[model samples]
Target: MLGEERASATRIRLLRDVGMLFESADVGWLLSERGAATSPSLDELYRGLVRALTDLAALPPCETDSGDLPASAYARVPDVAREVCDVLRVLLGRLAGAEAQAASSPASARAVVRALAAPLCVFAATHVQEQPWSSPESRSAASQLLEAAVRASGSVSVAEFLCGGTPSGEQPGALSAVLRLLRPQMTKESWKRNQATKFVFSWILTRVGRPWLADHLDHVFASSLLISDDYRTENKVLGVKCLQHIVVNVPAADLRQYNRAQVLYHALYNHLYTPEAQLVEVVLPCLLDLLSVLEKPCGSTEMTRRTNRYDQVLRLVLTHMEMEYKLALRRVYARNLAVFAHRMGVVMIRHLKRLERVIVGYLEVSDSPGEQSRLSILDVLEVVLQNTWPRVQSRLGALVRALLKLMCDVTADSGLCSPVAREELLDKATRCLLLLDRYSEGQIRA
Candidate 1:
């Protein structure tokens, strides 16, 4: 009935009628011998579900830039699609629930789930590509329905289906096919499509477990790299996040196999060269996590062997910080610098020359209205002092001068800062000064 040549509204009404009938019927009764004569057979209900899904999938692309569809048609498309999805969700939920309890055996339940995988995956992918037509509500319904369908399959996870079908190779899963369909849409010109594609990939990544992800690392890794390499900063940040997920999900041995870890390392490292503070901010933490997994201690000489990757990243960050003049980027670098310093520990002394210049340069200027960069730099200095006080003592004179100058500068701009923030800076500076005095044997006072 849904596949007939009828208006979208008529088809939706038919779907709603089917949904209402199912919603009113109890699953156990529907599957019971007594109600079996009155209620639709499971096979008949499954066919109706497929038809409704087909009606949904047959909607024209709602792209504004594409087809010359009337504006009225475009406006009506999402409403019609959302309604059909709502009905399909209800119908599928009832059918799946009934099938789980009604199946003669576990194999039968698994067979039904496997049969539904292709259609469900296609439908979910349609909703996930939500920018042009599907509403958020419809997309959410699709997710719930997909989950329900998988849960009914018992013992087989969505991840298992995605990684490979059924272990016996009965049929190839939809994940690879979905990726292929979405990849062409991830172009620079079609940003909405690109965004939608990423969302779909994110959904897949979330459902997949480590064992599954490890087997299909290339698919996940390649998609992340593609997004990270996009010209857009937002996509780049999301791509980094996806990579972070992969780092945590895939085991170290697999990540290091065929130098996959190094490839990821350089990808993130290349992102740091972009001047966008937002992208840089996300890349740093992801890099930190990836580094932990990629690099490991070999033996008793672990301490002596320098973490060259960390040092390389630190050097580049310090270089950028030294030359950075923008308040936002400086603030970002300063904030992250403290984190790196803490992680580096005494390894921070490796970049003392650049670090000193950055510290002095950052302190010389006033970040009015909040002085967040100065506050973060103060934190970095504190970490430096705590970890490398012996090396820091030699540079105490310049550091003390910078600290005193910052204190006087903060006082000079008293109106720029709230009383609370001003006091905090003063307190932090005083602590740094006191540390210098203590470490330098009153050299700061001198």
Candidate 2:
């Protein structure tokens, strides 16, 4: 025991000395010395020093009454952080081999796994906020270490340790750390579409689907919103996958506890009008699925109210589509006109006219080939029209005229399509005009 104490003291002293050297070492000299070193013993000593430095770094910063640590101390942090991370990389590699060997021996494996959690969590919690150490590569490595530790432990404690607490509360630190680890693996650029889909689906089913995690649905949704377009697409796809899993495995009564429909609506709203092309393709099909589910008539007042939420969401979606079209068209105040038209359609259908008017109005104005925004709007309109057709005939004239003008504008743009396609659009427009002529004549009889 006495000898061990002495050795520990010697190691700490060596770490402090190296820390000081790291603070003052000339870059050129350090590089030259590092390259010239040929002795295996010296190399081992150098590695040992690095490990000690890492241990020292994992120690919490000393609390000083003088406020935050000095700038010089803070500046030394990244170097220490990198050294610790390097040591962890080596340790994790060694641990992986050990873990593989010990897999069959549950008791021994648990001990080995428990031993790893502290350092892995400490490294993650400490350096996560340190910008220099937060590079994608470093963050990914740290995440892998924590994930491995968690897998080996087969307990939630490691997740708590990394995330700081259960997902029930507003603990951003732990959440951020865990998410940082998970995000890289789930990002669109990191995985092919199919692989990304599978990865996120598995993660949701295995990790985020727990009751404890479900309570933090708001955080999950918020994080989904903040991720990049690539991540958002992956996240939405995962949400759909999880929804499918829940529908299949869990009873409807149990699934209803999740407010799955509400969650789906929020995700759909965010993605339906996103500018990313890949995301649009991925999300549109999911939205169609949701619409089909919601289209069934409600049998109870409570169910009816929930169905009304779907109505509100659909209205908001249409409004957004019009806004997108007006912006894309760059017409003089087209946005205001579109908004006015959407509101008019909403009010008319909700109160006075048949739903057919709304469909005609959307189809008319939303088909502009020159307007990328119109393409998406047209999709929404088509869905609504298909589902709510005969109800839309009263407003059909206004709707058809708007659609014809959009078609004309789109076909006029040379960059949008081949001349054959342009002629087809003109023919469609001519047919729309003929319909208007016939409709106007019928109005004289009325």
Candidate 3:
């Protein structure tokens, strides 16, 4: 190891040389270094290990290098990697130990963990998919080490470390290989039982983005589905978020391949049955984005289907709004319902009867002093009038009655609505009334 006074570059070069030696050394030499009293310091050791594994990872295996290769030939190549794994195992243990003391010295422990995290994660990402470590036992160890390291360093740092470096763009396939190592830990049981594991999987899904994710759809989809299928609300939310990222970043054609889009559609649609307000709030926007990808409009075969994706979602959303009584959730439903109405375009007329009921009912009830639910419902009303004005004429009486009553309620509840909010509500209600009058050709009374 270089003295503290030595230049950092000199020390890095020395450690890198030690790493290069591992690339060609025998098992006996590797073992001797592992046991030597003059072993490198943690920083030097990690630097050396990463350098060695990175070289090995870049090597293409010989054509004859099968598992059946003579033990002598195979041992010489993988032994170096095995020794590095040994050193890493100890390093991971140290990180876990430091984290255990976090309560007493959070800043100090965090510094230690962060210092070692990126390099170790780089090592894992490098050789985790190469020969020897790609085996189940080796990969499991690598995944556990990753979980602990990421938990200690926090997801943001580890994600940046893995995805931000120079090699990410140059060797994206290598980066995607890291996903295979992480899969065991992102299983349904692990996702539900381990919050940190879920975070790791979810963050990776977003952080890696489209480039690396495009070639690795199976891993991305499986982990996301497992998270979504979990019983925990937080896990489900993470799953939804991951799904959203996938929907946006992955090619629409690829997502549609092999009924993958249908699988995602059913998964999100089922979540609407959930009573969890938080889950529903996220699911609606994601569903909206995904519906566009899953279905193409304008005389496509999808339009020929008996029930299209938009109608399926709208029917379910209206069903929830009709039965829902919680003001917070009603706000969520009303807010999203407006977008659905707009996206549905003139086709929104098909759901008019049920949509009219939800709009009227939502306006009648006060939700908070802000009247967010009623305001959102009013937006829905305007969208309805704008898109389906001719059909709205028959429903003007019911709609007008609701709007007048809402304005009266907003006016009467002076204490509930701040002056600003009250005026805003009144203004929006009056505008809806104007649209109603225009649609009615002055046939409607105030």
- Top candidate when judged by TM-score against the true structure: 1
Which of the numbered candidates is closest to the native, going by highest lDDT? 1
TM-score of 2: 0.43
For each candidate in turn, give its C-alpha RMSD to the true structure in angstroms.
Answer: 6.4, 14.5, 15.0
lDDT, candidate 1, 396-423, per-residue tens: 7799889988788778866867787789
Whole-model lDDT per candidate: 0.72, 0.44, 0.68
Q: Judged by TM-score relative to the true structure, which candidate is superior, 1 or 2? A: 1
Q: Model 3 over residues 46-160: C-alpha lDDT tens digits? A: 4555556445422233333121223333333333343445445554444445456633444444444545554556455534543432444444555565666665544435444
Residue 116 lDDT (model 1): 57
The order by descending lDDT is: 1, 3, 2
Candidate 2 residue-wise lDDT at 228 = 23
* Clashes in predicted model 2: 14
